[model samples]
Every structure is written in C-alpha cells, then in structure tokens.
Target: MALQLIPLPPALWTSLPGRSSVRTVADVIGSTQPWRPISLTPDLTLNTLLSLLPPAAILVGIASIAREDRMRLLSVILVGGGVSVVIGLVQITSRDLYFFRITNPGYPVGVFANRNHQAALVACMLPMLGVFAGLRQGARAGAKLQAAFAAVAAIALLPFVLANGSRAGLGLAIAGLAAGLILYAGHQGAWSSLTRSRAWRLSAGAAALAGVVLVGAAALYSRNDAITRISSATTAEDQRFQFIPQMTHMTADFFPVGSGFGSFDSVFRSYEPSEALLRTYFNHAHNDALELAIEAGAFGFIVLTVLLGWWATRAAHYWRDMSRDSSARRFGRLGSVVIGILFVASLVDYPLRTPLLGCIFFVAACWMHLEPTGRTQKTD
Candidate 1:
C-alpha cells in the first residue's frame, strides 16, 4: 500500500543529519558495527536507515496531494487503521495472538512488539477516521455513507483501545477526538449557536453512545488486560524517570551538535543512571524532547520548534478563517491533534521508534497541511 511509502524521505533526512564524522570514527573502526557509508551515525546505520524510511517515503509521496487525492488518502488511513484495530481486538483475545509472541509470552501484542506501541498506532489513526466521518462534503449520500462508516468504526474500534491496556493511548484518543469535534463544529458553524437544537442533540447522542460502548466493553471483556491494569494500578516506575537528569547531561555533553542522530541507543548507555531499572541498553531517550536535546541539542530544539511553529501557524490560519474550505480546516485540525498526542505520549514512551506508528504520524501531519484545492466557503 502507498501507506507504506510516505515515511522514507524523512528517514533519509534523519539518517544524514548526524553521521559518522571524525568523532564517531573510533566507534566505527573499533566496534563491530557494520559500515553504512552514507549514514551520519554509523553505530545505528541500519536502524537509522530503517527507522527513517517510512517517514521519508511519506514526505516524498505527499507532494502531489490536493483535493483530488484528499478523500483517497483519508480512505487509506481509515481502512488501514480500522484493520489495525481489528488485529488488536483479536490479539487481546489471544496472547500468542499476533506475530510477536516471543516479546510478550503471556501478554498480547499486535504486529508491533509492544502493546503500547500498538495502541499508539491505533490512536494515531483515530483522528483521521474522525475527520473522514465528520467531513461535511456537498454530497449528502456520500456524507451519510462516511458517517455510517465512522459510527461502525467507533463502535467496533474504540473498545479495543481500552482492551489494549494503554492509558496514554486512551488519553490521546480522547484528545484527538475532541480536536476532531472542534473541526466538525467549525465546519458546521455550530459555535455561532452553541444552544442550537441540532448541536445539543448531536452532543447528547455522542455522549450516550460513548458511555454505552465503554460500559459494554468493560462488561463483556472483564478479563481484558487494560481493564485489569486500570483496576489494579499495576504500573511501576520505569527507568525513564531515573534517567532524566543523566539524559539532560547527555544533551549538555553533546551540546549544539548531538552525539549523533540515531545514536541515542548506543550513546545513552554510558550516562545511564545507577538506579536505572535496565542498564543493559536504552534504545531511546524515551522523552522525545530530551532525546532531541541529547542528540541534536540547541540546534535540534530550534529545528523542532520551527517545524512545530510552522505547523501550528498553518493550522491556526485554517481554523481562524472559517471561510476557508472545510477539508482544508480539517487537515489542519488533524495535524494539530496528532502532534499534540505524540508530544504528550512521547513524554513517557518511545512510540516514534516503532516504524508503523511513526509512519502513520507523518501521514496525519501531511493531511494537516495539505493544500486546499477548492474555493473557500463563506460563513453565513
């Protein structure tokens, strides 16, 4: 699927930014790392290349997107996300369920090695489904069809998010849905009359449906790990909390230029805290922001800030001018929502390292800023 193609370009970019310069020559020559001639971080040459591919592909593929391809793109995301949800649902039922059995013997994981990663993948897809479902196109039949599909998706898919046992995903999913609701309301001019009967009815109905689904999911799948986790509050402090200062130290150690891009896994071990839960290997900074600081430092932060600023500014323009095309505004909302979710989740977990979720994240970002093809619709 073309869904697989969008993430490659960014991968290449990430790979090249921090490479095997004079600083890393010792690691390359003395260590067992296989040489990747073009890689910026030779230690993780293969991993960086693999990690960056999907995003790079996504960036390259999105150049042609406009109105003609908008719906098609949404369809692909919705369909792929829907399938992932199904896989998750099935995986939850059976622990040796998905392909990654070795990683979690008694626990269920999807195509991803971590259940949290699987949940993140699903969470990334939810906003698009909401966008497609809520998009108010001129065609009534098409619009209704989309609504129906969305309703079915929500009913079948939302429960499994809980089933997957990812509290972060659950929080992000709620935030993402709220963002979609704002886009929907903006398109419908619902904000102009908050007490309007139509608005009241829709809100009440959505609330009722959500309550029922959550209750039903709990009632039916009481044995679900997510439910049990919620009931027990079983999570322990991870090594991430302990390593925060040390990672900050790493960023300072590297300064403006990072230890290298894709070098977090290899470089973080030395500075790892004495109290660390797992000293063997720390593949990521865990906190993406800190990781960026460690790897890219002030420059990386600056670059990240600029890119986020650009996305936020573009989204604001779309959301502010109510007269802008509805689809365009929806794109902006989707991007904002995904960014928000990832930013929040990244605080605790390394979802971006997983190729599947990361690629979906890039796709959503493209949709958020995709150029509108039609004339703006005037608000009444």
Candidate 2:
C-alpha cells in the first residue's frame, strides 16, 4: 500500500509553496538533490518509508511464529510496557533519565519522544495484562504465579496511568481497565460466581475507591502537574479545530490524487490560514485521519474505509460466543480492542506516527488474525 505512488511521474508531485529565508544554507543545498522532485519532499517520504519498516517487520515476523511462541511474545510486550511505566515514573523525578534526546524533557515520556505516545502505549497494555493473565494458562511452570503477578501489576500501574496527565490517555486507560475486567471475568467463567457473592462486590467497590484515592494522593503529595493539565481548558478550537477548514481546502486542491505521502508539512504551508500562524509550525496535521486525507487524497480515505470495514467484520466474528477454550479468539478480541484505542487516540493526536506505538498497533492487528494451531505449528 505504501509503495503505490513510487512509479508515478515526477511532475505529478505537488510543488512547494515557496522557499523560506529561514531555511538554513544546508536546507537550500539539500533541496537541490536529484530526487527532490520525486514527491512533495522525497527526503521526508524516504524517512516515512524508513519509519514504516520496524512495524512491518514486527507484524510479519510475529505472525510467522508458533502459537505458543506468539503467546510468549505477547507476555514480553506486557513486561516491556511495565518497564516503560517504571522508567516514566523515574523520569518524573530525574530529568536526565530519558533515552531519547528530543523527548518531553522533565516529563514522563518513558522510551518515547512524546508523553502522549507513552501514555497511549501504557493504556493499551493495561487490558492486555489482564487478558494474558486470564487466558495464558498453558502447561507452563508458575501459571498461577503469572496470574497473580499480572493482577498486582495492573493495580500498581493504574495510579501511574491516572497521573500521566493526557486526557485521551486517562480516558482510554479507564476504558481499557473496564474491558480488561470484563475479559478477565469472561475467561475465568467467574461472572456468575462473582455476581452472586456480596463480598466480591464489596471488594470491587473498595478497590475502585482505593484507586481514586491513590490518584488523588499521588497528585497532592508530589504537587504533580498532571491534575492541573488534565483539568486545564484546551485550545483545540484555536488550533486543531481551526485547521480543519484549511485542511479540507488543501485536501480538495489535490482531490483524487494527494500531494503525496509525507507532503503535509510542505503542502500545508500553502493553505495555512493567517489566523493559525504563530511562532510554531505544524509538522503534522495532529489528526492522523485528516493528514492521511491530505497526503494520500481520496484514495487513502477509500482504503481506510475498506480496512475499517474489514476490521469490524473480523471483530464481530471473533467476539461472538467467546469462551475459555477459544484462546485464539480471545487474543484476537484483545487485539481488536487495542486497535480501537489507537484509532480513537489518532483523532486528536498522532499517536500512531511514533515508531513504538505504530509497531504496537500493527502487532495488535496481527494478533487479531491468529488461528489456533492445535500444537501442529512449526517453530519459527
């Protein structure tokens, strides 16, 4: 899908609005490269291609593995998320602890360059932790131990997610937690027993209350900025919403065929509204859907709609009559839910643009397509 435009004529590539004097001498020299006319900006288009490889590798590589190995790989992803949460927490205290140079300095970015990306990744992992604990009881050592660890980890991680300060992240985290609980109960075949027992009901209430209190305490004790940011009024009307009209105009200018992939930053400048201009620039459309519309044009929209329809059809099939025996289907359900979360997050921010989150998104899709092998599969 990404390679579809490579064979198109160079003259078809959208031209830049004008050269900015602010561009450095190197920028001017680099603009004259032989491949410059290939796309709106062939350099950025190449970077986009490079950015896509890791996620593609993850999707294909994992699908080729045995079912048991795939389950183990999912467990590793759960562990990696936990480690990222811990790193994010440490980063809150020590500004120098981040792995990326361009990350949200003095903020909880974890292994990502953006806190929202980290938040979205952590949020997606929350439900997977519960799902894995519930369904991953193969003939392995310490299966019970694994379940217990997942439960404790989920509880401990909840407070951090609440304190992460992303509105989208916080909302998704709560929703994922609820979905995880439902998936867990359904898998354990304990829904009837859980509902009949008043103790279980009371325990759940208490846990919920404790979580709220913990989030409050964490914010108050640390004098954290999370609460403030979360409660603060957003300027979406001034920026994101305002860009919509101009973005639509830009998309219409290119109509059926887009300016080209990775062309938004260059093409958008031509259509940027005077009211929207400021000291900063929009490297992305912020809304991945709209950006795809601008860069890939109407064809992108049609492709996305078809893909969405396919996802919905598969989800309906996998989600119908879920049972403990149907572990592959259950795993697929989890993947479907995670994909939904990433899709929602993309509406307001470019979570899927980042490599880590992008890889997670594709890996989750791969999980959705998995089928039971009945121990007949070959090892990768």
Candidate 3:
C-alpha cells in the first residue's frame, strides 16, 4: 500500500489549485505522474519512492522469518534498549552526537535527533521486555535468563525514559505499560510467573537501581525543561496546540483536496498567523493527522481512516486471542497495542516519520498479521 500511495501524492498535488507541471531535479526517471505542477513535481515523486522503500524492505525481511523464532526477534527488540542506554550515556556525558543537546547538555538522546524520540523508543521497549519476561517462562533456565534481561533493561532504560524530560514520552510510557498489562494479563494466570518471589526481588532491585540512575541523570542534566514545556503545553504557547486549528483551517481552505504532497512547509507560510511569526521555522504540522490531511488533502485523510479501521480490527482480534491464549501468539498480538501507543504518540508528534521507527512499525504490523488467529494454531 505504501509503495503505491507514496508516489501518488505528488501527482495529486499538481492537480490542486495553483499547482503546475514543473520538472524537478528528481525527475531523472520515467515521468508518468498526474500532479505535474506546483511542488508535486517528479522530484518529490522520487523522494516518496525513496522514503517508502526502507519500510517495504523491512516488511520483506520480516516475512522471511519463521514464527518459532519469536525468541530471537523479541530478544533483538529488548537489546535495543541496552544499546540505546549505552549510546545515551555517551551522548549525555560527552555532549556529543548529531542531536546532542547544546542548550541543555545533560540529556540523553542516543542516536535520535530528539530526546522525546529517544524516550518514545525506550517507552515502547520496556513493556515489550516485560512482556517477554512474563511470557518466556516455558523453561526454568529461559525464565531466569529472560527475567534477568528484563530487570537489566528496565534498570538501564526506564530512568532515561522517565527523567529524559519528554512530557509526551512519559505519558506514552505509562500508557504503553497499561496497554501491555491489559493485553498480557488478559488470560487468567497468564502472568503467574511474573508474580513469583524472584520477580518481586528483581523488581525491588531494578527499582533501586533505576532510582539511582534517574537522580544521576537529573543531576547531570540540571535543567527541568520538561516541566516548563508541560506548563506551556497546557497553555496557548505550545507550538503543537497552536499548529492545530491553523492546520485545520489550512486543510479546509484546501478543502477535500489539499495543498500538495511535500507542500506543508512550503504552504504553511501563507497560513502562518501573526502570533506564529517567530524565528523558529515551522516545518512539520507537528500533528501527523493534520500534516497528512493538509499535504495529501482528502486522500491522506482517507488513508488514515482506512489504517485506523484496519488497526481496530487487528486489535480486536488480538484482544480476543489474548483473553484465552497464553502462547507466543498472544505475545505477537501485543504489537497491536504497542502500535496503539505509537498511534496516540503520532497524534502529538510524527514518530512514524523517523526511518527506524517506520521500519519498526511495519515489522510489528507484519508480525501481528503473521500470527495464527485461532487457539488451535499457536504459531504463525
């Protein structure tokens, strides 16, 4: 679907009001496109194609994997937090990395351009690791190993997620945990192993470790910008909320049709209100729904609607399965809920825009679909 739709936005843009068929730098290949004018030139068409390929590639790679290899795939996911923790430690202390905080050097950003994005990845990783620890209790040794892995990941990653100072990240982390608890504990006694004495002891130790790490992180990054941002977020000064109604009007002005593909930053200039006339250049709509609608017009909105609908169906089916099944299948089903967290996060910021995140999103979707739906078939 992405392979098809990603390239079409430019053509649709050319057909919009005041659009043209101008040629661009990226139009080096075959030029069968509709929205030829305005900003939807063959160049953006090429950009779209390039943008969607990585996700498609990830899907193809994931499809080649077998369902019984859940341990391997899941272990990789858990290890992501560990790797991030190491990188984040370096970025915070050395004040290096491309997205390193110059304004406030004490924050952990890892490989991401923004701390919130880092926090989002960490937030999503925790519950998944926890879920693995809960579900991988089929054997005694594996259970012990998984438990230790979960504890270490939590101790290493949770403080960064919590104290990294992303308001949305913190909220999403809590929400993700709630979603995981719901899906994971749906079946009676499904998480009995997680409630054992060893689990309690590990949790205690992880909690103490996380506390120490969190305090150290805060000390290192002495500024509390997150609190101020939250306050502003509640007020009218928040850029995200400010972008909403303006974007809504912009979408309406363009009507059922929108400005053009990749035209948001270019087009936002005309709609920029007097108050929004700041030095900070407004690039994204800050809201994916609004950005999609404004750029792709009604077509983008339609795509979002269909995706949400399909997501709902998958989630419903997965929820039903989680209610009765305690197999790896149910664990795969957790992807649906994790995506739900991603969706909610999407409303506030474009997590899916990041290439790595986009790949993760598709991989999870593919994993969810591969899992067998019935109680009889345990694996995909």
Candidate 4:
C-alpha cells in the first residue's frame, strides 16, 4: 500500500495577512514622522517598524496565554526585569561614551550601549534552535522534512552570529549543544548507544575524522606567520577582572532596589575608580543576575527567583512525564538545554535584556509549557 502523509495545520502564519499592498502602505505610514505645521523628515524606517512586530506579537500572545495558565505572575516579573534594564540603558546616555556604541560593530543595542547585549540575544535563540530541532524529530515524515528545511535556514543564518565575535555566545552555543547531547543520551537509555548504532556510529566516526582534519588545517594556518600576526593584531586586554570588582561593589551599594531599571551606567560612572584599568565604559554589569538585582532591586531578585523556580518545576514535571513519551522526552531535553544555556550565559553576558532574545526565550518557554497530546509507545 502507498503511504499518505497529512500536512500540519498552519496556525500563526496563516492568520497573518499576506505581504500585499496593504502592508506596504501601513509600513510607509508607520515610518512617516508628522508635524502639526512644519513637517519634519521621517526618521523611522521600514526595517525598524518590522522589527517591532515580533515583540508586539509575543506580548499579545503571552498576555492571551497568561489569562489561563496562571503564568501571568511570571510574565509580570520578566516584564519588570525588562523594564528595569531599559531604564538603566536610558539613564546612561552620553555622547563620547554612549551606551549604544561599546560593543562589537553591527550589533543593535536598543537601550544597551554594549555588543554583549546583542550577543546575549543571539545566544538565547541558539537553544531555541535546538528545541525546534527536537520538536521536529517527533513530527510526521513530511513535517520532519519541513523542519529540516527550517534547520538549514537556521544554520545558514549562523554566519551572522559568528560575525558578532561574541566569545560568550560561542561558549553558550557549545554548552547548549553539549547539554542537548547529554539529554539525548539520557533519553535514549544508553550513553553507548549513541555510538553503537550502525547509522549513528558511522556518522559519529565520520564527524570525528572531519574534526581531526579541521584541527590539522587550523594548526597549519596558525603556523603561517601572516595568519598568526593577523589573529594577534586585534587582541584586547583582559579588563573584566578589574571592572568586575567595581561592579560588585556598586551592586552592594544598591542591593535592594537597584539604582532603578537601566541605571547601571549612571551608577557605574559615579562609583567607578579613577585608577581606570579598563578603557571602555561598562554598560551592563556583565553578570545578568547582578545586573537584574542592581536595576530591579529586591523586587527584581524576588521576581527572578520565582520565575526560575517555576521553570524548574515545569522542567522537572516534564522530565518525569517524558519517561514514557519520546516526544515529551525530546521537549524535555530541549528545555533542559535552554535552561542550561541561560544559566551559563547569564554568568558572562546579558542576552535576556535584548528584546529580540527576550521574546524568543518567552515564546520557547510557552512552547515548552504546552502539554503533549500523543500516547507513549513502549520501546521494549
């Protein structure tokens, strides 16, 4: 008998209007800056307006879900943290040392003046990529093919991420992948099985061989004086250690209700020592938890604790339920990877502060919270 495949229903994408003339008109009008008498030139661009849609859509979707899931409280906490970060970003505006110009080139730092914020946003989304990959694994064959297409699209976009030159983001991506692998091993019921299966084992061996070849190539490249010199030309002094202590001290001074959301630059300027080991202005504390505590105060800390607690509870619950359901197991694994990425990334960068990353995290969390409908099939 020939096999027939069922197509997945297009929910969100189908609900949106096609990119027709109406959208173009709306984009133009939205970008126009109007004056009562004398018209000033419009500063807004189409891309800016388009960028706003994701956050607006996420906020609306989250609000709708909050009404029933009892997740509203956590959402409020996230919003508070977000607001605080924005406020701090706003307060530290300056010409020579603008909060927006500190990070790597080409990164958008809405309220943040640092590239790390942009990198953080990218890092947060990396784990979501893993989640989507895992979800696709449980889908029907046709759906799985679509998912593979999406994965290719994601990988294609990776070069942009690499261009940001965020060491923290690189670390987060590696860690998230490792976490995903560990979770997969646990879920599959055997660590050795990952390398024992004929198909998987051959693939793994080939990958190992390719990695060795790549390392050899890199070694050859490093041996070339020109390549070594070019690589060393852009090295920045490690000033994090010196700056971190000052940031720590500043955090201590504003322990309860941080200097107010987005107040880091202002506070850092006031408290920063004259000895000045670091040449650049510190926009974020470089520690997400501390930054949250400093910006949102005690309330923010409490909010963070609650959100983390809820996430932990949900993860544990799903992890337990996944023992029987492979699909749920995949979701659980992806969720674990995301949580791990967030925890590790928080230590070095603040991706949660960027709206793009923040919305992605929020959406992924919502997806993770959803209950699966499929029945478990016994593997034995």
| lDDT, model 1 | 0.63
Deviation (Å) of 170 in candidate 2: 0.4
lDDT of all predictions: 0.63, 0.70, 0.64, 0.49
Model 2 residue 64 CA deviation in Å: 2.4
Question: How do the residues 139-219 of candidate 3 rate in per-residue lDDT, one tens digit apiece?
Answer: 579867866766676655545665577888866766555544444343334434454555445445544544455545545
**Per-residue lDDT of 120-196 in model 4, one digit per residue for the tens?**
54444444443444433333797477457535634433433344345665445445434434343344444433333
Q: Please, what is the TM-score per model?
A: 0.75, 0.80, 0.77, 0.55
Please provide, for model 2 over 1-380, each residue's C-alpha lDDT reduced to its tens digit, 9 standing for 90 to 100.
35533644323332332223322343667763222342456667778878898998987888788876766667788878878888888988776688876667877778877777887887788779878776545446676777788788877766676557676677677667766776665566544344335535644664475446545655655543556665675667447677888888877766666666787888788788787688878778878888888777777899889978978987876665443235676678888889988988898789988887888888788778876444321111
Say which prediction, candidate 3 or candidate 4, comes out ahead on lDDT: 3
Tens-place lDDT per residue, model 1, 18-111, is 3334336546578534333332355564555567888888778776665547546767766676676666666556644567534544433567
TM-score winner among the candidates?
A: 2
Q: Sort the predicted structures by lDDT, highest score first.
A: 2, 3, 1, 4
After TM-score superposition, the amount by which residue 318's alpha carbon in candidate 2 deviates from its true location, in angstroms, is: 1.7
Alpha-carbon deviation at 375 in model 3, angstroms? 3.5
